[model samples]
Target: MRKRVAVIGGGIAGLAAAVRLRDLTPPDTEIIVYEQSGALGGKLRTGELGGVTVERGAESFLMTGADGAESAAVALVKRLGLGDAIRHPARVPAALAFGGRLAPMPGGTLVGVPGDLAQLGDVAHADAERDHDAGRPLLAEGEDVAVGALVRERYGDEVVDRLVDPMLGGVYAGRADGLSLQVTMPQLARTARVEHTLRDAVRAAQRAGRRVPGKPIFGAVEGGMSRLVGAAAAASSARISLGLPVREIARTAHGWRLLLGPVPAPQTDDVDAVVLAVPASPAARLLSGVAPAAAAALGALDYASVALVGLALPPGTPLPDLSGFLVPPSEGTLVKAATFVTTKWSLPGDGPVIVRASLGRAGEQERLQFDDAVLLERAMSDLGALLGGELPPPVASWVQRWGGGLPQYAPGHLDRLAAARAALPPGLALAGAAFDGIGIPVCIASGERAAEDVSKAWEG
Candidate 1:
């Protein structure tokens, strides 16, 4: 019998799952990817401005994992024949904006949790005395806590507000007080399980993942992220169905049945296995009847909305020498982070200087309701203020808004996901940023793992 697998959602995660299924399953196995949106790359969109390429979504990904091994994303790039296209950012430090000035971001910090307290010079004050050993490990086995709660207790509010929050915000569009330590900073969380002090835990986590000197931590495709996405999609060889939402899924005697397309004119697909790679809400709805517990748990997860503004300044624009800066929420500004795209990346042409500003944090959806022009103006204003002078009008500008894009992994997220996975029936698997930690590498690994799980079930 010829086997068939359906991957719901055409984002990078789903696409990665399709590729893995093609690799692991028999040559005759049919792999189909159904995406609700017309586009394939979810948050990896690449755009153009002032005749230069720019990333409208995610710009780069970590090149290596915690074990100093090639990250899943980098591996996927190589597997898809994109290894040569990988471009590392220029060696320039980033800064943190606070107290009406910019200061170099502290080094030796695990997502802004200082490994050595003395490194926090003027960025923020760390309460050294509070880090005294607490007689036992900071966390018991199978326990989790918010990153902010743990850091604030040991360091102080200043460190959490100035350093940790901005760093996390740039990644998750979420505050440290809400993100789970186990999900966001797993290395530190692991060390906290056996380490008696927070500082010691940070140091231990840093030591475990020490990188070779001069090695670049992040990498991007030479052209744009879309190249990576397009390459992965082509390599998958999956039958692509775009703009079709999978309405529901139910177990069948032979395999699984999927309800897709519009309500009045619905479509059905029968496959040997199914991978749900959509966001939390839609995934929850699909699993409501089949895996109610999993649906409930997935439904409980919230998301953060954000917008990215790109500006292309004329040539010879005198910007700061740094890559960019992060704005803490305490700054009470609309812009949370800005990236100097031209300065950071080694683009080929002498194009205009490019700057990208990220705005809106978790629980700030109302702030993003403005029109594109309004949002762009606000971003420009914020950028000018941070630079201590008004910026020249850009030769080109672009705005991209993502509604409820980032998943907020609350404490106990991993435990709830485990229970949900346990409750799922055979032949059904979940993958994507909603289920695992965010980031290109993590999502790729999640999708591959899901593909493997479904393959095992099919074999059994």
Candidate 2:
């Protein structure tokens, strides 16, 4: 029988899997990709602004390679012929924006939760007025309730509310209180529960010779994340039908048959293997019959809504010197985080600056109350106050709303994933930010790992 593989969804995860399957399988093997949307980039989309570039979803990938993310990004760039269309540095600076000022993230701080309990306490120190008590140690308050609980337990309520919540707003876009610190922040959560103090864990980790990343910042191609996905799509051998949405999946004698949608004609494509690369909810619906247990788990993983409001302001504006600011969940607003785009990128020329404020994190709490117009008004007003002055209105504005934007990693997320994988059919596989990781590199690594496992299974 001819070996054929069907990859569902056309986003980066699916795209990466298809590309990997093409390389691993023999020349006679067949691979076909199905996407619900007309586009193949998934969460990655880009647009133009007076010849300048703007992104609606992801902006960059954290580069940790000695040669830089160049190699990882090379696949897509070469595939899409966009090698020269963009430039991404090896590193970018990260800062906390508060009181209209940017402060370098404390040194030796990893995700604002140090491995050492003492360091963790220092990092959690709140603004003088907020703390009220000078030199008061900020230990998390919660006792094994959830991620929010754990952070509050070790770092204190102030730290959890102000810094951790805001920074995580960008990562999870969900209420920190509900997040399972274990699932969302494995290292810190583990340290808090298992180890006596973060410092003890660090010493143990050092003895074991484990190291973590330094800076927690990421940036992308000048054009946008689409540049990377477009390149990946080009490199794959699969026949990509953009706009061709998959309606159903039926188990077959050899493998499976993917039913096409939007205008179902009962058309089905048979394949020896399949890879579903879409988000959790969509995949769950498609696989309700194929893998009930896995589907149920997928459905259980809650995904929250998100919106990005990109502002293009006039030049010569007296804006506050800031790289970005994270709004704590305590703010009780729709906005979880905001980044000073033009300042962060240091894009040449000052012709109107660019600032992107996040309006909805896991569905706007306060920020979401108002429509785009109201949100924009309040955001600009805040910006003006923070930037030091109320500047002219924006030359252009783009409000990018994601219905199911980011996945919430409740506690037990890792264990649940392991169970889902074990429950999946031996020939079936899962790969994407939804399960194991959420970053670009993590997704790439996930695709590669899934491919290796799938290849091994087929060989075995």
RMSD vs true structure, all candidates:
1.0, 5.3
Q: Which stretches of candidate 1 lie over 4 Å from their true place?
A: none
The lDDT for every candidate, in the order shown, is: 0.93, 0.67
lDDT tens readout by residue for model 1, 359-391: 999999999999999999999899998899888
Clashing pairs in 1: none
Report residue 184 deviation for candidate 1 (angstroms). Answer: 0.3
Best by TM-score: 1
The 10-residue segment with the lowest total lDDT in model 1: 342-351
- Model 2 local distance difference test score: 0.67
Clashes of each: 0, 27
User: Could you tell me the lDDT of residue 226 within candidate 1?
Assistant: 94
